[model samples]
Target: MHKYQKLNIQKLYQIYIYLTIRLLMNVMWIVLAIFLIILIFERVAERLGIDRWYKLSSIGWIFLSIYWLSSFIAYLDTDDFVNMLLTLLAAIFSFIIAFKIIIDNRKYPWKNITLWVTISILIIFPFYKIPILRDFLIDMVANHTLFILSSVFNASGEIITDATIILNGFPVSIVIGCTAIESMAFFAGLILCLNAPLKRKIIALVFIPVIYIANLFRNAFAIYAYGNQLFQFGIIGTAHESFFWAHNVIAKIYSFLVVVILAYLTFKIFPEFLTLIEDIISSFKKDVDK
Candidate 1:
């Protein structure tokens, strides 16, 4: 048996994060929904040239700040430094954006960004929480990946369950993130939230399924490499090493390149939208300089 002792507020804070983690996450999504509603109303008000509804966007931006701050704290208990740092920066940037939206004497389009974040979160958070939807995506990816391994690559593989694919003796678990939904959601929000022509947005939307197909092949390659233990050698020693090299290093680089190419394609298709992104960045930079 172990002993129970009281701790300081600093230590208590970390413990509370995971202790009430489920509640924290529920509140986070509820806040996000509220903000999404606000942003939708704000957009409508802007179109109708109304001030009161549009002014509510300041609260939406603050909700975004709170959303990311909670995400940052949730990740603090884990060992994922990269995720922690990125969420921290997101929280800070959202905080700053909220204030900028509030003191908009000159008026900026930061509210558009709030809508984008809201859409992205709406997609990611729900897909993560809702079991039926999440499982379907995971199953789709896993089954297709197992098929690719067995048929395309001529590798021996089997689907043990909806989310588990076994190649040879090793198993690979497929999560919702593996379905490329996050990437698709981001690009969906990107195409919809930005100032782009209707025709161009439709064209850009085609890449969502394209990314999913491409991700199937990427997942196939990762599973083949990791499950087959292809890199069981010096330096790249075990299953973990094979996973890191294939999934983390190689797959990540290619995935990033794919997104970059698609972004450049968007630039070509909707040239003025690039200007919109530039303005979004420079708006903050201009304030920082001042």
Candidate 2:
């Protein structure tokens, strides 16, 4: 009985340690996110010649306070309502700070930085927590892609379900990441970051849908290649699989080529974009040479 008791105690201790570690990890992630935001704000402020230590410090404190309060509410297990409310308040606060910074630094490239950061956040984080919107977007992309594939392969493919397609009995699932939203976001960010006219920006935005259409072609090609065994090979009675080539290599190459062509055309339309790209490339080369 004593041995069993001791074992139970050890197991309980292990579980306690695990929970403690998990809690700490969660806290660390929150703190790290806050720290990064503060750091980016300070860097942008310094660049814009608005480096007020007191204001930045206050902003950091506000973020830290929000994080701590939310953490406390979460620990109490009193629903996620309070936590979400606090998060919304914190976002508003951050936005106000960003707006003020932009207003005070109209001469600097604050607008570009703001646009880039905002679009990046929207792309990287699923702030839109609506499941229906997400599902609808994925379903649309998947269905359209499957339709294209069917046309190309003479109706050899069908959509099995939302965001999933079956071609020649091989199933492919399209997730949110596969919808090319990130690439569109990147293109939008680039266009907004460039020192271009409103007309050019609008024109660039008009072409944003082209990325989604290109992604459809990319998906169709990959699915068709995989289904038709376009790259399969064998050597001396040994069959070598080409799934990796079809799925990874072909998909990536197609996407990269499409983006490159689109970017080239866009840069031609907006010469400032080409200059920005050249500057970035030169700076990167210099850094590498160092």
Candidate 3:
């Protein structure tokens, strides 16, 4: 009887955690739009030199950071150590910036952060909630990924109409994140918003398609790695070590470096954007020196 009660408590705790995480994730999606609007207004106010806007904007930033904090807590449950760490770091950065804004509430700082983060989130957030758009992108990614796996890699795989790939007895579902839509959206939004010439913007925006193709290849590689049990050496005593290494660690590091490189290349094409970034840093540093 005692064991039964203890088991019930454990299951109840799991359910509570699951519900809390899902609730937080859902709220973040809804609030993404709110933050984008606030930041857009703040950006305009900064351009107009309205110091009063900082008061409202800084508060909004503090509130908006709940998204990152929530994500950090959610990843703790999934055992995604890398993502959990990254989200914690992001939450810290966001809160630090918010603290600075609050301290120097009248001073106009975070201009570039206002520009880039808002644009990126605005572009990326909608697709997550919009069913048709999410499904379309996920489906396309799964189709091409499976096709490349079958033809180029000579891997055996079949995609369920529901966007799951059963490859080499490993079933991996292709979600919207796997489609690389977020990164593509971030790149497209940043380039389009930059104060660069139309020609330069066009050139930088070309990276979007490049990113899409690269993401397709990345997904195929992950499928190959997992399906072939490339990292299933059982070193971690997990039967799914192949997937954990491929999708969580190796693929993530590769994707992060690739995005950083692509963003750097875009900066080279947009000198004004780089200057804006430097100015944002200077603003933060000035507050720190105070």
All models: lDDT?
0.76, 0.64, 0.77
Number of clashing pairs per prediction, in order: 0, 0, 0
RMSD of each: 6.4, 12.6, 7.5
Off by over 4 Å in 1: 1-23, 43-59, 66-85, 233-237
Cα deviation of 215, candidate 2, in Å:
0.6
Question: Rank order by lDDT, top first?
Answer: 3, 1, 2
Give the per-residue lDDT of model 3 (tens digit) for 175-247: 8878888788778777866667899988788898889888887888888988888897768876588888988
What value does the lDDT take at residue 7 in candidate 3?
100
Cα TM-score per model:
0.79, 0.60, 0.81
User: Lowest summed-lDDT stretch of 10 residues in model 2?
Assistant: 235-244
Whose TM-score is higher: candidate 1's or candidate 2's? Answer: 1
Candidate 1 minimal-lDDT segment of 10 residues: 1-10
Which residue pairs collide, candidate 2?
none
